[model samples]
Target chain A: MKKIFSILFVTLLLFSCQPDEIPPIGEATDYIPMLTGTWKLNKFEQIDADAESKSFPAFATVKDLTNVFPGHPYTDFSITFNPDGTFTADPGSSYMQMLTSGDWEVDDTEFPSAIILSSGSETQTIALNSLADVILGKVEFKEERKQADTGKIKIKYIYSLSKTSEL
Target chain B: MRQLIIISILIFGTFVLKAQDALPKFTVTPSEIDALTENVVIEFDVTGTAVEGLTDVYIWSWAPGLNPSEMLLCYDQGSPSWGSISDNAKLEPVAGQPNKFRLSLPKTVTRAGVEVTFNNVAELFGVGDTPGKIKEFGFLLRSQDGGSGGKQTPGDMKTSITLLPLEFEPSYFRTFPAKVSKNDVVTAYLNLSLIESSENQKLSVSDAFTATVSLLDENGTVLLTSEAFETTFTSEKEHAFSFIAEMLGAFPEGKSLDDVSKCQVVFSGKVYNQDESFETVSTKVFEFDFQDYE
Candidate 1:
């Protein structure tokens, strides 16, 4: 009887050592559900769109801020989007453009192309460059600042964020 | 010995570069003057010329094409010769400025010491009756006598040349967005009035005029071509097609449009015969004659 018990215990231990198995995932809400979580800014890229329009050879006036530069506070940024359409951010030690916090809603729930954020009377749009990667925990958003009067693109800003935790 | 040789080479290169930088720069007002334009203005910034204070400046001129044969050879009116240029080539100094001088082409006014009056470009360059393309009016500014101990601009300082705009009458061709790049959308236009009676009759019998365009490399090699777009005289005179410049070339893997060294456009049009046989009766090839940044 004791040997039988010991054999059963060893069998259970072997099964536990096996790697985790993820069930098949399908019928996802895709964008809004994936965005309802905490995200950390992984990278920020900027392109001088105006100079590029002028056909300047320096159309590559692109800046990808991965490594923080002195006096340029672009690191340590985090934001959270909730399922109820409310959002918040923690600028932390870096200065973040205060446009992220407020009631946020994607242009579409299934396949969002933009994230429209509204604070009081003003509303801003950030273009979603691609479908959210839930498995990889990554999302890409782009913002284009334009000349107010001329309505011409002056700068193109891209934000790559990684999911830090579930809200 | 090797280190000494390296040091000597570096010193010599530095001296040569300094001398080249000190050469005079000639800036033509209205830097771009069409061949048909008159009243040419020449401004000389003599801050770095070999001569000091620029007391007495002189002009030397030439017709760039045919040969570097001298032009404005009115040194001695009745018997003008290159040898007598020293007496007639002197330029007037710009008022209070010591390191500046000016020369007006077409010789509108007579200078204090100079003795020649050219009414027009033909008289100034002595074009006479014969006609040929004078691509550029070459020049080199110099001291009163470019002899020993005289200050002068280097051989490289030549005047800007103006090319006559290429235009065939009745119909015209042009491109939009003067600056073209690999990624931008480019439009090619061909005016198909077929306005002339003979040309219109030819287009009327056929269906329409066929126009096609090609993207060229720096060597004028056709990199890529576009499908022929057609336009009829009765429909509209302005016919155009738009496309992205990047779609032209097939670059190697990982290489893209940015690798394009030169992006120039070559557009051509064809008119069919009056018999409705679809045989090409006339073909016109046109280029963006204006400067394309290479």
Candidate 2:
């Protein structure tokens, strides 16, 4: 009888002490090397060409114009970042296209990493979060704008960017 | 007789163990995204069939990828100060802490979804020259039985900063009188109304949003300049400013608005904020054109 009681108690304790189930691993890492490719800019039909077009497509993605309003014209640009610090930007079905070649660098000083683009006459800095290469995920984009009459324009867009075949 | 006593004890122990498993859950009340010019207290109350197992409760900023350093500007000191249940109104800041604010969720949170109020006050002046943005606020409860403190929580259950639209309404105006003369004060008004999201999507609109207004003559020479005017007014909240050009100042002494060869206005602005654990929302820019004054 003593032996039977001890065994029963041990079994009950083991069953009650079971741990909670572990969640799936969903944390992401950075993608700094997946930017190497030759991209083809996509073109789109113009509805009202008379209206100052805000966004254009390139490198299989839509990116904004440097001179246009913040996030006004959703722009898609196909860009290839090589290990040598050179890049080729193509349009992704965007009629308004800008195929510019330049260098890019990342700033990790702050929490959300920033990428500064040195395209010919213009210089731009893009703040990025949830950065992953070759995988399709949502990322937050941040940029700063200085306007005349008003004050300043700080634009933020939450979009998905997946790694596609080189353009 | 010994056998019967052991059986009775076993039955009683089983019931007690089952009852412990039925402890009450915790819940946090939802709040409207209100605004204030100074520090505001966010109150959260924990009540209901209270449980005694929970060791501690914690509050965290639910927004992803925000700069921990920049967020420090929003708090009164550096951390969140807690008061007893009577009045959670007066909030003090925690000093030299990375997280913006924190709260204790002792075993007090009994019922599931316990309603709690947290005050988030707004201040007119910011830490430096910039007023940090208010992205979102939320809380997490932990069992504290040697488990992952707040990271083990399921989801972010709290209020967030709703992404707002750019305050860009582009329009131009020209002034002309029947009898035109020199040195006439020609003023133009520009209004920018900030926009926010409907679903409470997190957005940062403090120092991130800015406008640059300039006056250019036909020669492209800047007549007047104003850059980095850090300002934000909610949707339908209009901010008005006037610009005057001295026709005589541009050219010779006798030159007036009519005498001026050409005049024009250019306005540009953009908004930026952190998005996820370490990323930011795609940057946005807005531009407008005004009548050029000669």
Q: In TM-score terms, which candidate is top?
A: 1
Question: Model 2: per-residue lDDT, tens digit, B1-294?
Answer: 999999999998887565443322332223233222223333323222121222233333333433342222223344432221112211222344322223321212211234422223222112111222433333332222223231223234433344222122233221221011122222222233223333112223322433344444456554544443333332323322222244113443543344333344333333343452332232122222332212
lDDT of 2 by residue, A8-36 (tens): 99999999999978989775544554444
Q: Residue B79 CA error for candidate 2 (Å)?
A: 7.0
- For candidate 1, lDDT tens digit of each residue in B203-235? 334344555556555566555555665432323
Docking class of 2: incorrect
TM-score computed on alpha carbons, candidate 1 = 0.32
lDDT of 2 at B180: 15
Give all candidates' CA lDDT scores.
0.58, 0.35
